[model samples]
Target: MIDEHATPDLLELAARYGVSREFVDWRGRLTTVSASTLIAVLRALDVDASTPDAIRSALGDTELAPWRRPLPASIVQRAGDTPWIFVHLPHGAQFRAWAVLEDGSTRDIPQIDNWIDPREVDGVLTGRATIVVPADMPRGWHELFVAITDDGATERIARCPLITVPERLNTAAANDETKRFGIMAQSYQLRSNTSWGIGDTRDLGALASWGARQGASFVLVNPLHAPAPVEPIEPSPYLPTSRRFRDPLVLHLDVIPAVQLLEGPDAERFATLSRRATALNATPTIDRDVVWRAKREGLELLFDYDLKDPVRKRAFGMFCEREGQELVDFATYCALAEEFGADWRAWPQALHDVSGQAVSEFRDTRADRVEFWRWVQWLTEEQLLEVQRSACEAGMSLGIMHDLAVGVHPYGADSWAMPEALARGVSVGAPPDMFNQLGQNWSQPPWRPDRLAELGYKPYRDMLRAALRCGGALRIDHILGLFRLWWIPEGQTPDAGCYVRYDVEAMLGILALEAERAGALVVGEDMGVVPPETRDTLAHFNIDGTSVLWFERGMSDEPLAPEHYRAHALASVTTHDLPPTAGYLKLDHVRLRHELGLLEVALEDEIQRERATIEEVLDTLRARGALASAASSVEEHTLALHRYLASSSARLMGVSLADLAGDTRSVNQPGTHREYPNWCVPLGNGSGERVTLEQVIASEWAVTLLEASRR
Candidate 1:
């Protein structure tokens, strides 16, 4: 419950900042937040609401904040819609507002409202006024300028960032609202003849080509976001060091032009490293650290090569210019991570801030190391671009739908470089729910809602811009975070946390703007417990939702009929978190969770519940004629599952690569990390023997299974 002793001033202040006093829990019961947690969250947002005097001061500050500013940090609206802009000035001051077009032209804006009641605070007289914007503004970012004068003798200027979005998000494709099937794969686990210990962009291209041959229109892969630049590289792609850059570890060295320069001694070293790394391909699990060590040595040698291609040099320079300080700061953090440690929090105080003098000096002194990291990013971009090109050339219409991770690693590059962009004490997580009764703290910081507004959402916008550059489609993991995130206060249980709100209109508008510019389709992973109207809201913005076949069943425990599925969604039979259908039909996930001690009930009791669920699925499949007979094998059930998906009206039907390749291991088991080889599991057979990409592309079962997905 909220603090019984809280002053009205504090309560009001919290409300104005979008702090909720009570919420309905997963059980659909009303729940109130504790006082300490609210105070901690408020403090994280830089509000001092600890005492009665502090509450009074905060209330006054909130009232005067908008009054002091001539304009808000930014204003967003739909194209052809006019919204009133507010301006504050000295009492009785007169002001005229105009829109400054991006091309340096100006248009007059008329005043809309009468004088806001005058007020005297701290012996200073202040007043507010409103400007009426024209309804025919263009669909881009422009500037709002207000010129003010107390007595027409002195002049003052105020400017704010203004944006107008499309009335609705344009569909990802022109005439593809109907069903289209694609393959979903964990890229790193894609075993192939040419894999260099780990999967590379080349393997992704090959997979797309194979999928296209099988009559697929798109291929969605896991997040390829970069991990730590140095050794001890993070394994999971979802927790990346930087969302704004690609991981070089996934690069195919054979495609780099610089590899041709290794003709003498460099060639020998490269071959040795290549041989050592490729040896691991025969193994069942991927060791990212070993792979990085070998790949880094090769990249180091390539970085020293003198490139004489002026055109390529110019392109690299343009990339640097476009990325600007963000790229530099990431590279600098990578360099310093080697010097002090990967965690910037424990680093010397002078080096904590990326903008500080110490970091500048370090970059100047360690220029070679910095450039080496930057060079890696350039190479990564080239290869990713090539991957998209290869996929399109192979006839995949919506080729390479890249996944965008929801958060960054807590102690990684983004956290180190831009601390102000994220909150410090609170972590983004979920409350205790039916899916996870213990609750889940992702261990990544949430973006401070106040800070994001103050910075005009540049950081969020920049990340989207980078992620959309090389892919034909972009997938946002956990898209609900754009509207509201569950912020767990430091050292507290997840249930003690509260929701922190964001400007959904602004976030979705910027996302739509960027996706449109990239000519890419947007897909939101709108699975699990989300806010009411989440699907409708995503649909309003033309963002496709995610639908899993297993969870689409009705209250009667029967799979939904084809007509019951969503029309604007990417429907799949299984996701990375669950096992392939073959494995699921055998109760593999239930067994694994039980073994991991993650089950809330007794193993036998849970098994009974799952068995009932499985029986229902089988009955549903039988009724739809998807299953051939009552004695169908596991592989047959897998096909039946996808056969059901193919009949759905969903826009994009997705078939897992694991099912196609006959791999049984889950790519990720959400409850446990080290207990299972989460992201390291290779695509293999039932015997746990690794299956090469060559085998998969030519597998008869794969060919047979794909037919079930073709409508």
Candidate 2:
């Protein structure tokens, strides 16, 4: 029986748009999306479903929208497979179809006869003709060109983007027989004596070198994506202003070549600023505003230094030319954010449109400021390249593995520059699960699936290219999002949202293609409320999935044995969302969640259940001889947990830098924002003392655990 709130027509329209009417929740209970929620979500996708007449009209348009287009806006296929496209034209009309390769070559596409009835539109007959693409076409971005004529006179011409991607990702480790381990850390949380407050690429280079000496294979860090250019920047890396560019705040000034140009008061001011920022390392929390202000001032001084060398100028020109208009657009957004507030919506109406005359005039008038931002990105990228080089030189099989966040802030640069690519009036989040009973609203806008296809997934491709350019591997956060996202309507609670599906094949294909181009590895974060077939698909594409020690369970809800762990996974004992191994041993997650009012049940009961799960895992570890029966110390338990992970068939094992340093606090909490000071927490030892990267390298616990994992 159907709910009274949703009419049959409304349900049909929602289904046509890939919106779910009912789905199983995390708790294995069936939940129906309300009609009001459906209408709001449908409105977000630019469909009208508020009234019966609107639903009927949308249903009709949905049926004919494909027929109206001569060819679909885009076509994506595997490199080795032939893809067919349907072209619509006046009944019995003649047309020529061909593909223009990315290298400027052309190929004739032959037509195939597939039986389909003709439809009349506006008293004119229309037929759909199938055309076959050559399987031997080069794997790159190309275009399908169609010409329709009447009596040899060209009537219409249309073009569609053709993306030929790899059948499987390039993962060297997938074929290697050896098991490798790496250090996972939040890039900003890592501090060193040389860093000005927050961690820099230089710190990452040092950490990677040290880890390599300890027989590590890689260093996985948090997203280095840019935040708002203004003060009071959003602290969470997952909520970046733009995912397509790196944040300049992480640039280490001392190592930058431009810093050598400063003299007199400018040099003295830079030194004083650097000292003040370095003093921030002694504190327990990261003041990002103070850090950015100091870094921005230092960057401006460097930007002001004149470049008299022709070679340097040419290098800068080459970078700008290579980046092209996308870099220009991002830089322009940064400059405008400085003048107007960070939120583009609050800016003058004319400036809101990134391509409009007003914004163009603004860019022309404030060209210097825009250039300054662009130069900063170039500098940041230069340092990033050095860090990766150092990692590889240190003998890392996979160097710095960058993380890709799931979405972007609704009011940030990406949304401002490409408004059509993002959906309006809705945010991305998760429904209720075992840990987060109340659900979560991330406040980040979901990508518009339809628009992304129409635009040929350029935005997505650009982001992946930038992320993989200098890294050996990339970890996609919340990779489940590629298949479907939970869409929460504006002003609605997260539980009221419904799932919206995407073109998963296209998304995964493009990701694999980019990774293949860069010769990098891909690890998908496939945790939390995942569909059963999602992991299979990831493995089919040679993309590794994430597996945590505490979450692995068997049919009886007991901890899984080491041999049962997935081989194509990045196995870890702990994650950033949870406390380090030492803290988890003390039941910190349960206690903290209880204190934050994030628990639906009684705190004691939750703690009891958690303790029971921990005991079961410990028992398994002891039975496997990974832990001694008499081992009761936190350090012993932590080491034993990792030793257990080392025994797994998992191709890659990730050791958290926090755990290695004996850190007891979590770098992030899942549900709460301001209540817990989430991403601001600095790296510390068990005694809660702030430690620099140099000190962490010399830490006894870190050394011992790393050695144990290697053995």
Candidate 3:
């Protein structure tokens, strides 16, 4: 319940900033946000809403904000829609508006009627002038220039960035009606004999090739976003250090040209590291720290050799030039992390800001280390592109569909470099949901909605561009965040959070623009706590949704029929958050949650509920002729589940490699960090024995299940 003492002024201020005062909870109960929580969230957005006077002042600011500026921060619109742009100026001042196109051409914007008078702002009389943009304007990045004339004298000109995007993104293939199947794998868990303890681009390429051979059209992998450059790296890809860059750790060293030039001693040293790292494949859990230590030594050797080659140096320079300052800041952060520590907050205050002189000097002084990180990124880009090329050549229609994590680590490169781009005292999270009643705090900073519009969404656009660079498709994890994010105030429980809304029109417009430019398909992980109209909006943008078989229920809470499934979605039997199909059938997730103390109810009660759910799904499959009434084996059930997915009208089907190998371990367990080894489970068999990539691909069980998916 909200604080009884909260005044209407405070509630109005919160509403003005797009904050939700009350929301329906997972239990269908209306929950009002506490006044304190609202104040804290407002403060995080740089609004001083602690007192009545403060609330009044903030409310005034929000209304006068647009009038104070001559032109808006940015204008984003769909290609065919012609929108009116308001130009603010001193009363009686004349202004002319035009657009500087992306190709250096210009278009005149006509003035329109504006009867509403602007109020006095800061004691200066201001008036709004309406400008009608041409409907035939090209779809690209352009600049809107507004020049104001006062008393027949030319005043200063204001410029605003403008973008026109396609009306909706389309399916990756020309034929949108056709259904396609793909294989989903945790990238690092798919180790091979040639891997250096973790799966690399080589392994991913191999998987893509194998999937193509199985009549698959794509391979979906975990987010390959960069982690901490030094040791003690974060294991979960969902909590990446930077979303704007690729993780160099996933690069295949054998593909680097510099590796071929190693001398006798250098070769032996690299071989020793490779041999030691490859031996890690026999281990049950992935040790990223151990893998990094060995791989780093070899990477340094390659970096040194590449520096000496003129052609390689030129290629690196071109890459740097193309990446610009964002790449430099990431490399500088990595170098600084290696010198001091991964946490930038603990460093000296002068070194905290990437733009500060102290950090610039550190980059100049530790030039070699900074260059090494840049070189690593270049190698990563090369290998990822090569893998995509290989996948396409091997007959995969969509090739690799890359996963994009929702946000960056709170103390990672993005936060350290561009602190203003994200909120300071809030974390992105979910309100209490059915799975975890305590809710989930991802510990990642949410982008400041106000700042995103002010900056013309450059940070968001840059990160999306990077994720879509080398993949045929990109999956936006927690895509609902683009419209509204649950903002949990610092030092408070996740349930104390309120929803903060974003400009969905602008966000989706930019997304459509980027995806169209990349010629990639977009899939939104719209699974949990989604707003009622979110799917409709996503579908309008032609962005696909996610559908996990177990969660798709009908009005009676029974399994949804295959024909009832969404046609514009990526359907799968299970996701990384849940156990494999075999493990799910055996109630492994319920048992694991009970063991981790994450279950709200008794273990037996939870187990009984889970069993009922599985039985209901089996009944649906049996009715559809995809399963036998007497079938009891895990393999049989897994195939039946695949058959159920195949019978659906979903445009894309994803089969997890874990299910193919009969791996029982959950890739991740929500709400448990150290208690359960999240994101560390290697691909293995039912007996808990480690299975190599080749073995998983060649397994008869894998072939049989894949054949079922193609039905």
- TM-score for all predictions? 0.96, 0.98, 0.98
lDDT of 3 by residue, 1-711 (tens): 234466898888989888989887877788898899899999999999877778888988988999999988889968888899889999988888889999999998899887777679899999888997788888888899988999898677999888887789854552266899999989998899999889999999999999899999999999999998888989999999999998878977777788888999999998898889989988879999999998888999888887789988998899999999999999999999998889999888999978889999999999988889988898888889988999999999889999999899999899998898999899998997878878999999999988888887899999999999998998999999999999999999888899999999989889988898888899999988886799999989999999999999888878898888889899999999999988899998988888888878999998888898898889888887889999999888888889888989898999999988889999899988899999999999998899999998889889888999993
Q: What TM-score, to 2 decimals, does candidate 3 have?
A: 0.98
How many clashing pairs per prediction, in order? 0, 0, 0
lDDT per residue as tens, model 1, 140-217? 778888889888687788888777777666744623575688899889987577778888888998999999999898
Per-prediction CA RMSD (Å) = 2.0, 1.6, 1.5
TM-score of model 2 relative to the true fold?
0.98
Better of 1 and 3 by TM-score: 3
lDDT of each: 0.83, 0.90, 0.89
RMSD of candidate 1 to the truth, in angstroms, is 2.0
Residue 225's C-alpha lDDT in candidate 2? 95
Q: Which of the two, 1 or 3, has more lDDT?
A: 3
* Model 2 lDDT-worst window of ten: 304-313
Error of 2 at 112 (Å): 1.2
Please estimate how well model 1 matches the true structure, expressed as its whole-model Cα lDDT: 0.83
TM-score of 1: 0.96
